[model samples]
Target: MKKTAYFIIGLSLLFSLLHAQDFTYFEKEKNIWLQVYSNQLKAQALDSDIKALERSIKEAGTKKKIELNQLLQLQTSKKKILDELPQSFDTMLEKITVESVKDINLIEYLFTSQKGKFNIQTQRLKILKQEFDDAVAFLTKELATTESQENRDFFKEYQLKKALDFFENASGLLENKEEVLKRTKQSYMSELEAYKQTQLPIHIIKIAILFLIFLLFNLLKYFITKKIDNEDRLFRIKRVLNITFFLLILLMLIIFNISNIVYAATLIGVIAAAITISMKEYLQSMATWFHLSFGNSLKVGDRILIQTNNNQIIGEVINISLFQVTLYESINNTTALDLKRSGRTVFIPNNFFVTNYVYNYTHDRMKTIYDLLEFKIPFTCDTKRVEDLVTEVTLEATEKYMEIALKQFSSLRKRYDMRSREFRPRIHFIPDTKSSCFILYIWYAAPYHQIMELKSQLSQKIVKKLQENEIEFCSN
Candidate 1:
């Protein structure tokens, strides 16, 4: 209660003091203080103006120096006049002893001034801020110019360099006025930092978007080409897509403003060229794959004969890959009969296509192939009769195969310039005196894949027929 009474007493005193003042006396004092504040600012401006005159005089000819010094002296007089104006305000302030509205106004004036002068050096600060704003404008113009240039990468570097130069220049200008320019410095640095912050995310987004586009383009190209059965065509299209992706990246790297585009591109090119030169066989295989994929000569699932190291690798193509052709190997004995699968998978590099001849049975629509089986018969049998019987029986046995083969290889006949072909056994009489025997060649045609089954059946039938006829066969 005592503390409350004291506060009330203090409030009453303050109100009584305010009421005692004349009408608008505090407002009058405040206006007077405002004038004093304006005069103090003028004083500082006069000082700076005089200093500027001095600097101008220092750089002038003798005649011009005299002229500038006279102007500097005139400004010094004006500063002296302003200097006296603050003292009058101080004297007036001392006469107001009561803690009234005028006193509050005086306190406000004191807070805004020090040593009877304006403490705020807004003129110099405004000039410096204008300089910073001008520099920012110039920087913006530089960015616009950089954006207009054809060499975006180089010009963006130039833009950043010029921006840094402006920042350093502004920093140096502000360094001497650290106390006064603190806020301006913060504003300048924050602006630059903001630009960098925005640029970083944009750069990251550019790279990510470019990568996604590259991946998507490749996936789309792959899916579109995936259904194609032609290996060489697919390989060619993929090659073009890959090269396009790389070039697009090179082009967009400039737009992304990545600093290392030239260096990165050069590095990639050097590494790729080195790898290409080092892996000649791999490169050759890729080229060979391209050729075979479009050459219509060899494809996956086609039966082929790849002769290597003085031996023949007869196989059905299982896969056609970038570097190699995979095969499911098969074999036929030297007699061209008893064809059987060896069950060995073979990988033949496409490079070997350049160095060796490849035979593809499925090319030219010649899916059916002919093989001959020769049997040595004793000279005791009538050779003419045996040949006729063997030919007739073999023709009957291969009748179905011939019907299908002739229909399929109509293309082959046109390709090979052949008039007509008959599916029948051709017997030649070869006298082997050492065994006193003659050989009969039983020729027949069958699909390459069904050759083994057809040969086995024909061999069994021929043996059974000979046995039934009581024909004696010579074995060497």
Candidate 2:
């Protein structure tokens, strides 16, 4: 009876040990199977996502389609990874089950390798998610700022919708990937926290410094230019300061942020090339404006005559800008017809300065130009008498202008080696044999704006003097 009881107890103990060993093996197999099942589900979801992205690409606009294709490539790559992971896990799981291996260290090693790969995937997904979030935010901002209903509708239907869809899909995938990583005894949140600790503060400092620099420069610009009274000079100075400010900021940004010189140079070169190509005409105009501003070739309130397409435009400069020069058309000796079009504004492109000739009537503030008065008289008339009368009338009409002109000419002479000339009124006569008459020419100095008025005064006086002297004028 004692031998029988001992045998039964030993048999029970042996059975219990066998059951415990089997249970341990089953638990490990079950966990791996669960991982396999989870990965398969993820792979199917990624495949569906890739297919959906391909379809969306077809329905999207040109730019949107390109973005969707990129998304599709990313999704396909992820599915490939998922597809590969399941095969690897299955092979390891199969080996464990078929070989009935009591130790599954090889499976653990495979899982460890897979965790590293999944971590890489997680990082990629994080970057993709950030890009999508930025795209969606940008689209939202554009939609809000767009005043046109047509534009708003287009953005909502196309850009915003596609961005939102991409964001949603990426977010779902990221969550699943993070969940997988958690099960592998790795947490993405810890890595993220480490990155924030290591890098985020530095970025924050850079941004804060950039903002402060921008503010300081703006304040300095305002303070320096606020006291200036000359509007034209102030505007030109402001433009120069603005260009300097932009270059300084750009240089500082490159210096502060870009560690790689090769990359920085390439980026700068590319940006410069794009701007030069896209804004060729405008840049030319701006460069010409710089020349005009510093060279003293043009200014506001100066009377100028520009010849364009065989037509003459005489006006007073009202404004000079980077792109164009504005003029207020006025009556002048060069273009008398401008009297009817007086007060009208004319805009000449700044780049026109390169190809066209501009005649500044009031150059160097001289404000005076020589004007001619011509009339015909019979050839039989006394030449001496006509000359004397014409000269007398011109001198009387332009008495005040002669002194001012002489002073201006003196100043101009100091600056340039000018040819000497008689500053006072002069009279000349040319016999017109075809018409049996002599042309009496009177030249006088007059203000640019008052040329017509001065001419009228001299003409009335000269004609009266000729009539009083019985000098018969030729009808032709």
Candidate 3:
């Protein structure tokens, strides 16, 4: 009976020892897994930092470039170390399971192997932490010294402030990552399980759905536009499709976080108010554009004259956009000397139409205009003959446009109540007392753009006729 009791006691002790060893093995396995996850997180963060540093290097000056390059190298090396960490936690666990728990030698070997790996990981982390601390201290000292020094250079001060902000942010990021790493090291199995649960496949599906929707919208636009032949209609359709797609995207993004609807609405309202206040003039211009588009007061290819305080501008409307009207400066009978400025593009703000008068010469499709030509003649030289000669020459020059002008006037009379006016050419005599001569004025109907050339032709014809008829002009 005594021997049996002693044997039973010994067996119980052995079982207890085995159970304790098993528990220890499980804890070590969990610790290795935690470290592996921590390394992965650190590597992701380092990747983000590396990309940011590379971008900063592109824009940084010579001195800053050197410092950033060094920091970049340090971050790259740290990431490489993190990436090389053993990620085969499952394999290691499987290996432990394949071996018998009663095999003490096997357990010892596995434990030592895992412990060595853990120690290497801890050592690497310590080295990286020390480097981060050194970088933080150096940056903080540099920032404080830079802030204390002052100069009169605005650009230099701005650059210094930017650099200080970069350093401060980097320091804050490093400190935050270090705190996270420390917290993760102290975390338990519950926290690890929670992290695994949070990385659900649904999140990936949501992202894929968003990309698919974007592609579908683009395809729809492409197919719809491909069938349309009219450029104007296509442009309008494209604009509408783009706006619709943008609104749809916003709606989807909002739906994705419907729990934060109140916050989103508030943010949107604030942004809208700010934009309205800051872009008041631009908003007005855009509103005016809608009116110009639907209203008949303005259209592309119309001749318009805008009078300002200092001078008048006459141009042909080439394009009408959302915020401005584009015009091609054209030489007119009134502005004949502005040849140098002709054909140059002019941009007029759409808001300019609200307070100013725009004179459209071709209003109601009136294509012909009355142009005047003036020449001086002696007060005593066959006034009646000169008048008849001028009238005859003017009538011949304007013969082609006379019928068109008459028809346009007839059409206008039907559309609007107006007085009858002569469409034929006419000659008038004005006495210039200061110049001691009579100014012969000849008025003729001509196309809006052809006025300058037609006037030149008429002048030559009139001078030739006068010379042939021995008509003398008064010379100063």
Report lDDT per candidate. 0.65, 0.68, 0.69
- Tens-digit lDDT string for candidate 2 (387-470): 887777778778899999988888778778998555798788898877988888788898988888888888889899889888
Q: Residue 81, candidate 2: how far off, in angstroms?
A: 52
Compared with the true structure, what per-residue lDDT tens digits does model 1 show for residues 1-476? 54554455446435433433212221233444334434544554556566656656656667756766776787678677767776233343333222212111223433532222212443444454455555455455655666788877563455346544645564544444544344543444464456456654665687689979888997879696868778888888888787788777766755554466775677667757976899899899999999988887887789988777777788889998888999987655522433344768999998999989988877767788887777889888987777766776787788888887888778777767787876545668888767778877776887788777888888888877777777778878
Model 3 per-residue lDDT at 332: 70
Q: Candidate 3: which pairs clash?
A: none
Clashing pairs in 2: none
lDDT of candidate 1 at residue 73, scale 0 to 100: 81
Candidate 3 lDDT over 380-422, as tens digits, reads 8888899888888888888879988988888778878999887
How well does candidate 3 score on lDDT at residue 177?
45
lDDT of 2: 0.68
User: Model 2 off-target regions past 4 Å?
Assistant: 1-260, 337-340, 431-434
Off by over 4 Å in 1: 1-273, 334-341, 414-416
